[model samples]
Target: MARPRTPLLSPDRIRDAALTLIDAQGLAALSMRRLADTLGVQPSSLYSHYATKDEVLDAVANRVVREVDTSGFARGWRDGLLIWARSYHSVLVAHPNCAPVIASGTQRREQFLEMANSVHGGLVGAGWPARRATEISGAVKYLVIGAASTPFGSGFADDVQVYLDRYPHLSQAHRLRHEANRIDHDSFELGLTSLIRGLEPGPGQTE
Candidate 1:
């Protein structure tokens, strides 16, 4: 004989469960029924919290982003940009399955907007013009998303190597030395620093 099961389910709980499922099985595997079953709740119960699967996805993305520790950004603009970029990169890499959904549906969440505003404010306060700050932020974000989403498979790697082999000059200039090309979380900080340094005002320049 089997015993009955019960578990309390709220919006946050559902979202956490969904995140765990996505992390384990990829984003395509997530569905209301699956989440409900995991939580021991009826499928209809999810609708009481999230109107649609997209809503649940939005919540998941927000949850991932919220895991980033933005407190260290209080130092200054340079430190702020480094922290923001690395934080985003870390969070996205942690949930590779959610990256595509995040790239697509990020705008649907208010927390996304709030994070953007906070970055913008920090950049603006650091002496960057509003337009430049916004542009740079957007560029850095797209770069991170683009890099993270790059497919890693035997076929893709072989194709890339073959293409590079054909271009002698390009191949020489862009060597794929494993040690040199390897970039962990700290590597992103170097890129952020370089970009910010290039954007910084020269000596005697006004804000």
Candidate 2:
């Protein structure tokens, strides 16, 4: 058979296979043996591409982080922050199983580091003090991480009686689980807006 234009195995294919496995079976399912099986190759093949599971995970994380948009920084710091947070949240929500790895810091991943540099640089370029700029980055990261940690609405039980008896205030809470997506999204929007709005520049600073 003629050699295929695309190689049977490559970093991209490995990363994608890892992602699919994690998405279906959670992060623990990722391993050289399992990944090789998924790719229809020998475990040794994966070793040639990635030295260890962590290396593969880092690559997978970089791939996901690459999808987050950093172009909003050009619009303005506030808009950039909002856009970045929303985009990050959307990506995490789409890949809940992989969110932990992505949020676990860049781990020397160039793409993730580049994204971090843009956010910080945009803030400083917008006249934010260096310390404050760092703080803002940390804050937004925490917010996005928290929001993606667990779906908010899903925390509530689907049974109306769960809240109706003693906690009258939460009478409608039971319905929230069914509307998890909408509620979680709206809640994130509210939190992101509130957080960003509170970041007014200090004296000698620019908004």
The 10 consecutive residues of candidate 2 with the worst lDDT sum are 198-207
Question: What is the C-alpha lDDT profile of model 2 across 1-207, one tens digit per residue?
Answer: 344586788888899999999989988888788988988888887877888888889988888889998789788888999999999899988888887787775548988788889899988888888898889988998888888877765456545675687888765755566777897888889889998888775425555
Q: Which stretches of candidate 2 lie over 4 Å from their true place?
A: 1-7, 153-171, 202-207
lDDT of each: 0.73, 0.83
Model 1 ranges with Cα > 4 A deviation: 1-7, 151-193, 200-207
- lDDT of residue 81 for candidate 2: 92
Q: Model 1, 13-100: lDDT tens per residue? A: 9999999999998888898888889988788877878899888888888888777655544787667777787788878888878888
